[model samples]
Target: MVFVVFIVAAIITFAAATKLSTYADALSRLSGLGSLLIGTFLLAVATALPEVTTTVTAVFLDNPDMAVGNILGSNHFNLLILAVFDIIYRKRKMLAHIYKQQRYTALFGVFMTLVIALAIFMRLDIPILTIGIDALIIVALYLLSLWIIQRTPVPEQEKNHSSQEEEYSLKHALMGFIIMAIIIFISGTALTLSGDQIALITGLGSSFVGSFLIAGSTSLPEVVTVLTAMRLNNENLAAASIYGSNLFNMLLLVVCDLIYRGPILQSISLSHAVTAIFLLINSSLVCYAMFARKNRRFYTWPSLVMILFYILTMVWLYYSS
Candidate 1:
């Protein structure tokens, strides 16, 4: 029964995500926001609604481990999106042609993941009005990342699409984005419940369920958006969407912390540090590959290592936790 519900919810989420990506792209072009900005802020946030909704639900249920795991897990799962893209891309390496903003965005992701890991390790008991210092820092740093990325100019070639006459009205696009978001919220909430049930029935633990199962399920929109962007031959948007979605996933933890009474970071199983460490490693590798322009034959080496690391971390989490 749980499996059936999970599958149904996943299907709905995917269908909603397909439409959401279309409207998000239209909104970006029509609103004069450009793909990078819109991908980072608008599209990214919309796609991340699943993670946001799922994490909020977990926290409200007093499952901080699952809440934090979903964020960290989602961050790493997003990196794996690059690996999938690499496998399908027949052209040269995917990351080699990405814009400079994407490179910087990956760097910022690594830095923020590191900050989160440190907080978990330190397990600070102190909280100002029930919010940990780390939670505040994560939120502040996320805003700074957005500001920097927005200010960093995208290549003129990339702006060509935005200059053309819009295909959809601002009202239509906004409405589409909203309607799809609501669908995602409902499906995502269902996914969270099913994930918890699966974890309980199988003894996989919330950390494992959140990091691998829930995170991957919530990230379905990202998969669709990336594939769509790549098919359109819009590599920049594809790359930007991944990094941007990751940024929003990190912020979901802040929402969890605010809702989870007490220091959310310190309260969850420190075993989560395992997932966080893997996240830092994966994000750093992505930054290196992007900056170095390493385009290996078949697929990028960094992406291969990324998949391997994620699998190993999952194994470690399963047994150790």
Candidate 2:
């Protein structure tokens, strides 16, 4: 029964995520928002719905470690999705096309890494106030991205776009958004329950189940979307979505902590340390690939390197834990 629930939830999660991405793209076009702003804010928030719902549910169930582990684990898995996207774009070398805009994605990736590192390494007491601060940071960064986009000059081709092409029907998009949100909420809850049952049956910890299984399962949506986007020649959207999702995950942690009330740091596990190390290494590689313009543009080698590193890290974590 538990295994069945896990499978069902995974299916729902994938469907919901696809719908959410479609709606997000439409809404962005309607709102006249640049990819950077829409990707970082609206799309980011939508993709992270599962994380938010699952973590909140775990916290309410008094499984704080599971909640934190899910976020950390999801972040680690999200980085792996970048490699997955690269693999899908093998022939075209997706990164080659975005040599100019890669810097923005790299910067966002670095910022997300710093935020996660601070959460993991800093020994400061996790107060509710910290959540408010984190929320402010997220909002500020999103607004800043929008400002930058607005101030930047648009290319001549973009300036001549028709009004009909830019505007999306809001009623249809909103309906789709709501439907996706319901699916994500329901599926995430089912997955959380399944995780708890598996932990109980196997005598494994909830954090262990949430981190390795649940986190990886739930992140499939982001992985599939990125790979699909890459295949469709939407390299910019793929990169934006990946980075956007990371920022959303990090910010959601703050919200989860605040809502759960008091000292979240106390519940954080050593698994977070391993996850953080992997994130730092993966993010550094991304930044390097983006900035190292003189090097060969092909991401085949870098993608392989990331996959190997992720696998090794997982192996080490499993044995060590």
The residue-level lDDT of candidate 2 at 286 comes to 73
lDDT of 1: 0.83
The per-prediction tally of clashing pairs is 0, 0
| Residue 256 lDDT in candidate 2 | 68
Model 2 TM: 0.84
Clashing pairs in 1: none
- What are the lDDT figures for the candidates, one per model? 0.83, 0.67
lDDT of 2 by residue, 1-321 (tens): 789988989898887777676666666555555444555556666666778777788888888777877776787787788777777756666655553544665676566566556656665453445553434555566556546544654333322332545344878887887788677767888888788677778766665666777788778678766755555455655676777777667666666667776656455676666667777788877777666643665557776787887787666556544
Worst 10 residues of 1 by lDDT: 292-301
- Looking at model 2, residue 231 earns an lDDT score of 50
Per-residue lDDT of candidate 1, residues 16-52 (tens digit): 8887777877876777667778787778888888898
For candidate 1, the clash count comes to: 0
Clashing pairs in 2: none
